[model samples]
Target: MADGQWWRDAVIYQVHPRSFADSNGDGVGDLNGVRSRLPHLRDLGVDAVWLSPFYVSPQADGGYDVADYRAVDPLFGTPADAEALIADAHALGLRVLVDLVPNHSSDRHDWFRRAPAGGPGSPARDRYHFRPGRGARGELPPNDWHSLFGGPAWTRAADPDGSPGDWYLHLFAPEQPDFNWANPEVAEEFRAILRFWPVRGVDGFRVDVAHGLVKAEGLPDHGRSARLLDLTSTPFWDQDGVHEVYRDWRRLLDSYPGERIGVAEAWGRTPVRTANYVRPDELHQAFNFHHLTCSWEPAALRAVVDDSLAAMRAVGAPATWLLSNHDVVRHATRLAPGADRARAATLLMLALPGSAYLYQGEELGLPEVVDLPDASRRDPAFRRTGGRDGHRDGCRVPLPWHGDRPPYGFGPAGGPSRLPQPDDWAELSAAAQDGVPGSTLELYRAALAPRRAHPALGGGDDLVWLPGDDAVLAFERGAGDEVLRCAANAGGHPVEVEVGPAGELLLSSAPVDHDGAHVVLPPDTAIWWIPARAPRAAPASAPAPASTPMAAQTPTRSSTSALGPPPP
Candidate 1:
């Protein structure tokens, strides 16, 4: 890939800062912790790391409720630490993309704090959507729109006169007041925020709620059953005006050097609508939630892949594939029954055309901590619904870096993690799997090495479906001598398939036995085959030594919540 288009085929690792590594014995991951781990990512063979939100916030919704975009929260570290971490990552040939929460701001933000002190119609109020409530005594909410977490979207404000106050819009928790994008000051402020971090040396941003900056012109009632995943034509999401905001931001990003980019966490009803966010003049990429939501069934996975590739191709953008992120149950637990299936799924994801996103801890085969106590649940979604729906905290537990006990070196000894780690995680800890042949960690290392070195592995937007049984998915990427083929068996039983003259075994998610003319694919396994003439060499960067000690400590008490939406 060219300098400006590295993201096109890059393998980007998502680092949930709080759960990654804790420095200073605070039990919370910080910038210095990330800096210390730069060699880990460099050795993993990924081109970049996408850090989750670590901005100054009230922690009501993790760091997504930004109190100050330009400042780093004390729980994570200081501004100087952020700059040093970015520089260190770049030094390791890894780009850094920090999370940007543009949809809303913490209620504790200066603007939000001062707005309530002003009367209902004051300019301060205009910066956000503060309107009078409906009904004779202003008892009713302004509209029927619901918060993504739960309950009414509008929350009553404190009036300057000490009377029943006007309502403010918050698509998420009440602690996060939605910005009035229609207001010029709102746009100008965000534009300033966009420039602030890049000037500090961030390579780009992963825009949270990228489809939600603009609401419908009238803030009309949605008038339907409100659910977090029900985003179809909602008044508060995916509005046409959001594109204008991105176009302006894109211009500002292009003005910077080092090919700075913007990635969108956009959820649209269709692939075409999702592609709109990545138009050449707008953001650089958008997550393919369609693929993430796909079932393990061969037909479903095939369709999602086909549609995603086509939609991205139409807009001349790369299709970014991901299996599990922080908000969802880990794929090892959610996609199928075990680790083998998750490995196969990942292999399939990595072999496809375009970029891939690997969530932190996934390489270690960590499953979701599903048994977290009710008292330990911290997601606002869970609190809002009284634990009926959201349990995202299960996936946000601190990672087990080493040792064979709880916290597993996740933090300094004697300190407890913010979220509990299961005792069984010892088997899945990085320390246990590191350098173990055929381990999931090694599988990822092996896969990523070739992805970076073999030209046929990561680049290309074309895929040709090869004939296979109903339970099998087969496709070839690239053309001529560079062609690479991938076949995945989703069935529960082994399936023998013909190996054409072009087939040369390159990598497999599971053990595969081959005869003179056929290859036997194991159940829930995927394999990558390339032309025999394809070049093979060690990856440019070597893997980190097994004994390289990472800072493992417990999490400190902080109010941070989960960073993004609950997975669908």
Candidate 2:
């Protein structure tokens, strides 16, 4: 609503740094690689760029186990490289957001390393959750908790004298020991960590495990955890104490220049619980995972959208939408029917009111590499969960920038990507689609450029659902002269729907048959159309926005306006 609140409507691109781009022939993406690619983001028209963990880490859990929050991992680059990347991004009119891992640290971290040496009742041990075993000989784990990566959350460590001293809590891998947020020193240390990045011009943080940090008091025994979209299944997540930590971060962000913000990577028990992280006095926004988890059915999509919007609106926060990320199967494959369905979903997500997040390589229509050999797999979930949802490595495959061979220009000819690219990635390379009409890359560019500048799009809450069949979702956003119609055919076979008066066929996820009033949308296709007619007048008792003529046209569409809906 104000100049400083750019996050409310930002389109942020998530960069999995190690897989995004590689420079210096190292077969690894570094901060300088990100800097070199700033122009691509500028051209793509995203408002901001978010980097996943690149801090000093052991590559355990893919950088989530942080050893040093302030230093850059040599695998990525130096601190100077990070600053240069931030500066370059800003120069290219992009804001920079870094991932923050405050819930836990690498077991190799100095503090965690010295924890055992300090012995029981020591300040170092106090920083983390270290408890005595439950049995007489102290052989059993302290609690009934399970690690998110799979197995016992508690790992027993030897005492300074080499005896089994105490068991430490690690919600994820044993290398990632959870911090004791109950401790004042833990909060104070994070306070300084929060202050460290802004001075270097970080626009915001995408808080990792934002729903975590504060566990239920007394570390109560909880049953086996279910890995689901709802993170609050157990006492460890969505606790009331988590909000206080975010509120403190909000205050710290507000005091900083550049409108610094924090966006939660939180998955709550419900949309309402998720909204708590984005309250006016808390963080700027929380990711709405429904877009990724919701089914492709029309009713399901609309329901999740309404639920997400209502929840965020209650807190005066803008909703966030996403489809695929590094942690899940790429939507290109998950949504199936290949690129068309994925493209259709993209339009639907963009037409909705909120900030949108795009994962790296999504525009290139990359599908999940599901067949990676077992020996090449790196996701710990492979072993931890007995291969349940362990395909994260599939989505983390390095992006192919150009060229037509293996690696597809990801690195030097002899240098290989950390993860293998699919054989067909040659045509999917950005170079292959650079100027190809109807290419996924071009479609994204078309949608993003308009979504960025369209008067009624980007930031607003004025969306009205238009009547349509159960297979169709039709809605108009903005008001009066600035109105734009969006609809999706989330069904099999074609369905024709009347969308009031004639509108310009501005964009379509796929070719569709439509006139001014009626459109026949194919299964898994969507459209962004606008009516050309006299503007609605405001009530005599109220002020009205000045009517502006709608003349902007950008997306490439085959106008079947004269053909009407195809026979079905």
Candidate 3:
């Protein structure tokens, strides 16, 4: 609500450091590359850049497996380079947020090495989730809750003294053992870790797997263990006391005035459960992933949006929205008719209230790369799940930088790269789209700029779907003079409707023609209306055919809306 609260209506761009750009001819992206690209991000007009984990990591889990919470990973850049990038980003009027993986660390970390196999008397033994009689030689840990990456979550290891004695729980990978948040030492360590970046001017953290920070008291075998032998417990996630941990971090974050923000990645839980992690003293916002997982039906979209909002309001916390991320199939492929559908979805995402996160390449309307080699896979989920879907590597592919050379859109190499570069840079390069009107990139900028400019559009009341042609998804944002009506055609066919005498188009994804109370919306388009100052004359054309309701209209709203449905 305050000007200082920039994050309330901010658009966050997620960058996977290794794939963003490469400055020194190495295949992977580096700090210098990202620093060099600050102007592009600034031009794009995003409020903040949410850089994925760059802390010293083993590259297991794509940097989620932290070895040093404060140092920069060599693959990314030096600590000094990171500081410079932060300064550059700030100078460009962009806020920088780093990924914090307090949940675990690389097993190769000094602490992990001290514990080795969770052996007795190891200083790091208690740093992770360890259970008795679960060593590599002993029977596996007794739970069946599958890892997010697939397979069992338990991994056997030797003690620091080379003694064989224990097993540790890894919700995602063996390298990322679950941190024992129950331990005061661990909590303090994380607090210190958080302060490290903020001291260097990092705005905040996008906390990794926030809900999975703690586990259940007893390591009981989750009933599904027979099928998932590697897991230790089902109740291990979203356990009690997580809020206490987050509340502690919230306090730490408050030490800095303004700029500080926190968003939690709370997958696998209802918005209610997710909201619990975002209370006043907890996370500033928790991700609402319902839209990403839902089908392209109006009813489905409306229900999820309503539910997610209600959940957030009930908990007195803010919500964040996302359509695609490194872990899921690109929204383009996830929707019907692919990119066109994704464009419509993006319009809805921006029009709704809350903080929005745009994944790199999403604005380019890039489709998921279905063709990927098994050897080139980056997501362990596919490996553990027998490849039900290809690994996330396809979605995490390199971004083309206006050149049709090596490394596709990434890296400094000149020829034949890891992923073949696309033939046309014009279609995807930031430079190519910056000045082109109606380009996906431009549209994204337009979509977000309005929200940033108008507070009424970023935070508001419940989005109530106006009853009319079910083909169009329409709702009112805010109240009184600030109330803006946003309507979009979620279907492939065109929609024409009455806009009430006072309505005037504020924004639209599709072409709009209005006369008096009647408004015509082209196929797959949108129109935003503000309460008109006075009544207008009527149009000459007749309204479109009112097809019998095949289904209910969908009124999707952001989770942060003061009023809305609860997330399912």
- TM for every model, in the order presented, reads 0.93, 0.93, 0.87
Candidate 1's error at 186, in angstroms?
Answer: 0.8
Best by lDDT: 1
Residue 298 error, candidate 3, Å: 1.1
Worst 10 residues of 3 by lDDT: 548-557
Candidate 1 C-alpha lDDT tens digits along 1-568: 7787788999999999888888777777778888887776776668899999998988898788999998989999888899889888877788889999888999999999999888989999998999889999998999998887988999998898887899999988999999888989999998998989888888899999898989888889888857656878688778899999999999999999878999999987788999999999999999988998889998899999989999999999999999989878889889868778998999899999999999998988888888999998879989999888778888889988888887787778766787888988888887787666567876787677766656667787988898878888988777765777788899888888676544456556766665534678888888776645554333223323222210110011110011111111
Q: How accurate is candidate 1 locally (lDDT)?
A: 0.82
Higher-scoring candidate on lDDT, 2 or 3: 2
After superposition on all C-alphas, the RMSD of every candidate to the true structure, in Å, is 7.0, 6.9, 7.0
Q: Is candidate 1 or candidate 3 better by lDDT?
A: 1
lDDT of each: 0.82, 0.81, 0.70
How do these models rank on lDDT, best leading?
1, 2, 3
Q: What is the Å distance of residue 481 in model 1 from its true position? A: 2.7
lDDT of 2 by residue, 8-54 (tens): 87889999999988887787888888888777777666888999999
